[model samples]
Target: MESLLDISKAEKKNKLYDSITPNRFKRTIIKDWQLYVLCAPVIIYFLIFEFGPMYGVQLAFKDFIIGKGIWGSPWVGFKHFERFFTSYQFNIILRNTLVLSIYSLAAGFPFPVILAIMLNNIRGERFKKIVQTTTYAPHFISVVVFCGMINIFLSPSTGIVNFFIKQLRLEPIFFMGKASMFSHIFVWSDIWQNTGWAAIVYIAALSGINPELYEAAKIDGANKLKSIWHVDLPGIMPTIITLLIMRIGKILSLGFQKAYLLQTPLNIDASEIIATYTYKVGLLDAQYSYSTAIGLFNTVVNILLLIMANQLSKKFNDVSLW
Candidate 1:
């Protein structure tokens, strides 16, 4: 009898909790209605522009005839993917993309952090602002304009770079025309263009760090370098790791614009990346299904990399996107 009564009481309590939940939810909605209204446009934008086009990903699996709509098209499964994998250009494209992306990441990743730290240590406000403005101005230049500037500046006969070489009696080199020079030019130019803008995030992170930590480090007889090493680095490590993980996740996603603009017949071996190839095949060559499969593969790889990086970050540093 006691057991029966306990069971009946438990059921009644559960029933009461369930009955209260909807009322509580309704009250919350009433209180937060304005916040929800503010969020509605962003939510709607993502649903329409981002999530809506996901339906077209089906083109990757189908032969995709325009006459036969998406649902009407017959599926070829992994045929296009297999063809891409087996193609002769596969190795070359993948190699060039990986090399450029990895080189860019390795060369460009630390400069922003270094810049931010250096700027943080600056004692003169006026001088610091001048340096910041000088560095940041390049980021505002359009990519096409930047590429044009590169071409003009690197021209063998007429460019300033070659003018210096001529003074030294050395042969003028075509920087953009050489396959080996392509990665260097791309990486260094990008670093010069974007480092200051990228450092803003790190600078913001550094600003949020407690000033008392620096004082404590000085009290402990630590010098400026030691203080930075002990306090500044540890304080901003989470930001660094988060950014690093994001960069790693996009290992294969090199920008097509600058690469395409800088590409010449001589440097095509080093510059034909996945993005440019996809654009050519998909839009220019009219191989819609094939290009879709390549894009899907690229996306799938990026997603896997993101998951892997997140997991590794969580395990090692206890910081992750999740």
Candidate 2:
């Protein structure tokens, strides 16, 4: 009986192996030919444009020389990372990155939500359209042009802001040159540029909210603010959570373009961030490997923050990216 059972088990294992074996690629193509065809271009694009370039990440671990190329370079693992960590500029750059990101996240994140709520509450369609159009126009303005306008508008000698200061018997302040004003100017400019554009997504989410919920809240004698707090906010909480998670994921990243464009020599102490640091190192200094290491570090931190935020959101509110 024992011998028979052993033979039977061997046969069963062979049968299972046979059942699992097949021309998997052909079978998959046959099963979802159209879907595969549709995704082929996107898959190919990412493979070429995204994953292909990922090979260069090895530069971060190498003592890269232009003549030697990335693959031919001498291995110097963690040297650049150590240099960046111990450098005198490390704390300054890290502090600027954290403080600016936090300020932007705290101040810029809610403007869109508030704008969406207000715009949704508008009784007049024409008025709402006008407001949205006026607000969104700024988003399309080129960064250089926008910063130029800001400089012109804030110029101490002749600018409108300084003129107002003069009228109020206050000494003229050069807003651009003030380090203390850098984060506020960056955040408010971001809000002004992006608030209305961001509102479109929140407004779309709000539209999907059931009108019956509002009606029920109204019947229960809830005022406009109370109804919004109870019904509208709850309805949009998922959207809010998702956006908040995305915001947290970008907590260390501020786009280099606007900040770089707006940064003056006087404000460089406060405006220098990881992105700008990378740009200067890679582009200006031509220290490709060191810059890549810094970039890789930034990416890892962003990923970690994203995971942490998602976990916290799930535990606290039962809302998560996954």
Q: Give me the candidate number with maximum lDDT.
A: 1
Local distance difference test values of all predictions, in order = 0.92, 0.90
Q: Positional deviation of 51 in candidate 2, in angstroms?
A: 1.4
Measured against the true structure, the TM-scores of the candidates, in listed sequence, are 0.89, 0.89
Model 2, span 215-238: residue lDDT tens: 999999999999889987888889
Error of 1 at 102 (Å): 0.9
| Candidate 1 lDDT over residue span 58-177, tens digit each | 989999898998778899999999999999988999999999999999999999999999989879999988888899999999999999999999999899999999999999998978
Off by over 4 Å in 2: 1-21, 30-41
